[model samples]
Target: MTGTRSVRPGIRFAAAGFILAVLLSAPRAEPPPLTLAILPLKLLDTSGEPIDQGPEHARRLAAMARGLAEDLDAGGDYRSLLVTAETLRARCPDERPDCLLAVAREAGASRVFVGVVHKSSTLILQLFARVADARTGRAVLTRDLNFRGDTDEAWRRAGVFLAGQIREAGP
Candidate 1:
């Protein structure tokens, strides 16, 4: 009777361990590896036309992509092949990878990111971003990022938001 009572807790613990082991051993899904192309950071004028090329905005976009890659690398979870703003500006539009498959092959990336900037209302600036898979030519993620700033602040916010999205977004 004494041994039976004492073994009950041990049996319970064993059952719990078995449950935990099964849970841990269960198969987990994974995101695939791919290259990401970032288009030039276009700053639309007050008239809603792309007229200004804010150096700061351009730099921010490039930095944002790089930062996202860096953060992912630190965790050792995924890899990002990011192209710089300078390359986008330097290349001809026809030569650039605005399309997914084209972007992936040209930029040597598996995915592509195309973004547009629009000044919404008076206080908010909208950064419309889209992610496309180069292999499948499908949009994986779509997000409208907003920033509160005139010039420098806008890019800064864009950078931060891009980083956050990448962290929250898998692969």
Candidate 2:
């Protein structure tokens, strides 16, 4: 009986060892990427000059916003969803946190990104950006970037830099 009991325990120990080995060698499943809703970039002209709401300026803003989304999506950390201007104006005209969060929830996003370009002059622009939790409207990341020149290249560079910053900051 003692010999039988000893053999049973040895077999159980070997079985456990085999199970542990299999578990340790199995590949882990990575979590799905988080969905992010990126709102249209708002242009606020504080340059004290006449507001240039021309088509060219509007085009640049839209392009910059799209570039940011592409940069972020390229990282594979976030699935970027671009929000249209008409939807933004119609759903969240005031852009309050609650309103934005609602929009994000409606879009099936886990997070929301918002940005504003403050053009101080023909040569200077400031970018204010934030990422917030869609469910709680809590800010996860915020960054302010200052870049010179009003050209398309300058704006594109700024968007790239901001995207890198957000990725590094884990937003």
The global C-alpha lDDT for each of the candidates, from Candidate 1 onward, is 0.64, 0.89
Residue-level lDDT of model 1, residues 51-83, one tens digit each, is 554565566555655665666556554455666
The positional error of residue 2 in candidate 2, measured at the CA in angstroms, is 2.0
Model 2 clashing residue pairs (backbone): none
User: What digit string (tens of lDDT, one per residue) describes model 2 on residues 1-171?
Assistant: 989998998999999999999999999887777889999888888778675556777898899889988998999888899999899789988878898889988999999999999988989999999999999988899999999998889999999999999889874
Deviation of model 2 at 38, angstroms: 0.3
Tell me how many clashing residue pairs each candidate has.
2, 0
Candidate 2, position 80, lDDT: 91
TM-score of each: 0.59, 0.92
